[model samples]
Target: MQADSDPVTSGMIRRLLRLVLGSKGYDLPFKSDTDRNFLLLLVALMSFLAVLACAGTLTLHAMTQRWSSGLENKITIEVKAETPNGEILSPESVKLDTEKIAGMLEGNLAIKSYQVMNEVEIKKLVSPWIGEDFSFDEIPMPGLIAVELSAATPETLETLTQKVLSVAPSARIETHREWLQDILRFVKTLQGLAFLVAMIVVVTTITAISSGVRSRMAIYRNQVEILHLIGAPDPYIARQFQWHAVIVSLLGSVIGTAAGLAVATLIFHLSGKDETALIPEIGLNYGQIAAFIILPLLACLISGTTARFTVLRTLSQMP
Candidate 1:
């Protein structure tokens, strides 16, 4: 009971809560700063960009994970439209080539299943390029075989490559694993870049707040010196700037967050993707949405701390 009733403990708890939750009081004349609204706008803009950077990083990781899982054990065998000598093959030759590849796949125990696309399916695949209205029957199209494997091991790839070359000399084997790995590497680099951008935004925010604190201190330098002469400590003065910073940060973050969400939603809606498409949809799950709320709180915390430290450091130098 004595510990709980200690004046020092009670004072500390009140200060900590005031620092975190803020209060409606300002010792320094913050209203006199004509450019304070501009400061809020700048913070809001930076916060908006930071939100986008974080969301982009998350979305990219989700996309790459989806692509990696869906493509890892899959491979494609592309039978060329022309022979090695560059002469176009007849439909019969292409059909025979697919049959030979299918037989080879059946022989390999590693192959879980394989499907040779029919002429209609092949035409449909190329519909985006040549148009669905085109009715040409003699067009030489490269045959594609969709192959799924039980395991896409290195030995499986090597053995399959050799068998494919022996059977169809002009065919190309595209192991999705190889290309997917490259894509994952690229995505990771992009994620790193996004993280770097987020860090830059944070630094920018801190710098802006520090500059504002300095300017505010300068504006109220007379009042601050008199407060010091009357024996007011630095923390006593620090709370003034801290509470104002928290208020501005909270208001700015609210606007920034709403704008960021609107823009993200607009981009996602305009992407023209559907459930049938292989492209991963851009969205935030409940967890991601909840995580997003932390961004504003973080901004407020950073703003308050920066303002507090800047005010304390500046005030300590006053004579």
Candidate 2:
């Protein structure tokens, strides 16, 4: 229990109590002070937790979009022609086939973008495997045309692939269904894990806030006892404790939100690494960034309201 008359302790508690309930705001006969320490601590905790959750969710959403955007309606076609030796093909034939495939793709409404690989580009591609001395002029290097379709069905891709193969007998279309499926599954799993983490943090935070309030209220047992002796109403006493709890939680929320947003900003900043690396979309979108701004306030509201109800319930049995 807190001492009734230690000069420093008395002053601190009085100041805290006043800050919480506000001086002259209530006419309660008992001490009406705010616990500023508790309030600040709670706000910090809430802010961090809220930001962590929001950032995680936003990141997951962005990553999903990235993966989907990459795979959506895209296919690659490989073209090859048999040489006199029958073991290799000519580079010119490969280029011609690629151009023909590109022309075929152009007529279809579903085909949004098509890039035909030429002899020089194909030579460069094969240089990694064949070395610089290898002449793609004499031997056929497989030509590839990267095609992006505009919201086409899987059947449409199949039909397009057949048509291309019929016209360019040496060309083969490779559908990316398996790879796309794997990417989708992975994105979904990441999203689910992020959500689970958020739920766990929220539950842990609520428990911490409740326990802290209970602990602080325990130290006021003597004051509460005096108030009871003087016939103070339970509501009046409960109001003081409730107010204290709300203020404490509000503090934790503020702290938590700040920490969370800072971490998110750092992640966003660091995402500008290698150009070729599959970096997740780390920057916050318009809606998500807006949500982050309000997340701290929402946490304060939730924790404060929850604490008030919890304290009142606990105080209901008091005489």
Q: Tens digit of lDDT per residue, candidate 1, span 192-225? A: 9999999999999999999988988888889988
Error of 1 at 90 (Å): 3.0
> lDDT tens digits, residues 1-319, model 2?
2434433434644566677667743333223334445455655765676576667767767776776777767888888676435755556666777788777888788788888776678777778677778765555568788888887587887788788977787777776777778877877787787778767766765776677556655766677778767887776776765565555554456567767777888877777554545565467766776677676566656666666666676677565
Off by over 4 Å in 1: 1-24, 31-33, 132-137, 177-193, 273-279
TM-score of each: 0.82, 0.76
lDDT of each: 0.80, 0.67
Per-prediction CA RMSD (Å): 7.0, 5.2
TM for candidate 1 is 0.82
Clashing pairs in model 1? Answer: none
Query: Residue 204 of candidate 2: its Cα lDDT?
Result: 66
**lDDT value, residue 180 of candidate 1:** 78
